[model samples]
Target: MLKNLEPYLEKTIFNSRWILAPFYLGLILGIVLLFIKFIQKTIMMFNTVFSASVSDVIVNILVLVDLSLVASLLLIIIFSGYEIFVSKIDTGDHVDRPSWMGKVDFSGLKLKVIGAIVAISAIDLLKSFMDIPNELSNGEADKLMWKVIIHMTFVVSGLLFAIMDKVVGDTKKH
Candidate 1:
């Protein structure tokens, strides 16, 4: 009886591809988020152009860069996660995947994501500083300080990740 049941169990386990269906669904959701970000930035850019304030223009530019970075991150996670854990992207012959996509291993992707996060954090911190008045309340200054500290932490962590990845690569090469 156990032997007879073995094939059925195997089939059930093998047909578990449906479990990964949600990940693909999530990727589609991410694409939608990307589109929304793009549209939001476009509107912001138009608004900035109409406004007379130079600082507002600079802020808008920073926001645009931040959005682009976020979109790149979404693409990395969607493509790499899908390829590594789910299934390959169905790019036809006419469409080519990005060259960096081929080169980024899991460690590389992690480092890149961390680096991007650090950059985004730095931009946000700068934006906060730019908005600060000549005399900030104690609470506001404290909050800004915490943000700067968090941004610095992300910067340090990303640098460490890159260093560790390099060290491991060198060790393997030797």
Candidate 2:
């Protein structure tokens, strides 16, 4: 009787990877939220294009791009995390498939994530600089400097990740 129960328990534990299914589903829902936000921002852009300052319009566009990059990052995490940690994604005969869908190993995913973050940070820094006249008038130099510092931190972190990946990749070749 114990021997029979052993296989049953093992199978159940093996199948327990399904527990992560809901978390991935939740990420999908979050993706939808991002899409909605993007659309909303786009609509606002159209509404304000004529009346908004040039800098304001540019800043709005940058916000949209930032949202898009974040959504893309989440997509990579969702698809890769599911395939790596959970179950295989059996998308047979699916045309319009992404090139990097199945090929992004964990290290590649980290690099892509870091790269996107650096891009986002650059956008933010540019946006802040675009507002420098206002920042100076408002006595916000300290805050502006902080933003620049934070952006540099992200840049350094991305560089470190790339360097480490290169070191590891080179060591593996031998």
Candidate 3:
């Protein structure tokens, strides 16, 4: 009786992976929302182009870049996470299929996520710097300081993640 129950239990547990399908669908919705915001920002930028200063234009462009990066990061997560944890995407002989779609494992996903985060953080910091006032109040100064601190933290964390991955990879090789 115990031997018969073991196979049934294992099969049930394996089939439970389908529970994650809804989560990937939700991420697809998130990408659609990002697209809407991207379009809105583009329209606003176009309306203000003649009146905007170079710095303002640059900041607007950075905002668009930031959105694009986030959307791209979401796409990577959706594809890689689904493949790693749920199921392989069946893109049979598709010309447009991303080369990296099936290649990124969980470890690679982690690095890509962190790298995108560091980049996004850096862009935010740069935008804040560009908007700095000639004279900052205590609150403003503190806020800017905290932004710098947070950005540095992300940078350090990304480096640590890379180092740890490298160490693990080297260990596996040996």
Q: Pick the candidate with the highest lDDT.
A: 3
The parts of candidate 1 lying over 4 Å away from their true place are 1-21, 44-49, 90-95, 172-174
TM-score of 2: 0.84
**Model 1, TM vs. native:** 0.78
Instruction: Estimate every model's Cα lDDT from 0 to 1.
Output: 0.79, 0.86, 0.94
RMSD of each: 3.4, 3.0, 1.4
Candidate 2 stretches with Cα past 4 Å from truth are: 1-14, 134-139, 172-174
Candidate 3 pairs with clashing backbones: none
How close to the true structure is residue 135 of candidate 1, measured as C-alpha lDDT?
96
lDDT of prediction 1: 0.79
lDDT of 1 by residue, 1-174 (tens): 999999999988866755776876786687788779878877867866875477877777778777777877777876776666656666654356686655567897798789889888988887887788899999999999999889989988988998988889889564
C-alpha positional error of residue 7 in candidate 1 after TM-score superposition, expressed in Å: 8.7
Alpha-carbon shift of residue 144 in model 1 (angstroms)? 1.3
Residue-level lDDT tens digits of model 3 in 47-70: 999999999999999999999999
User: Candidates' TM-scores?
Assistant: 0.78, 0.84, 0.95
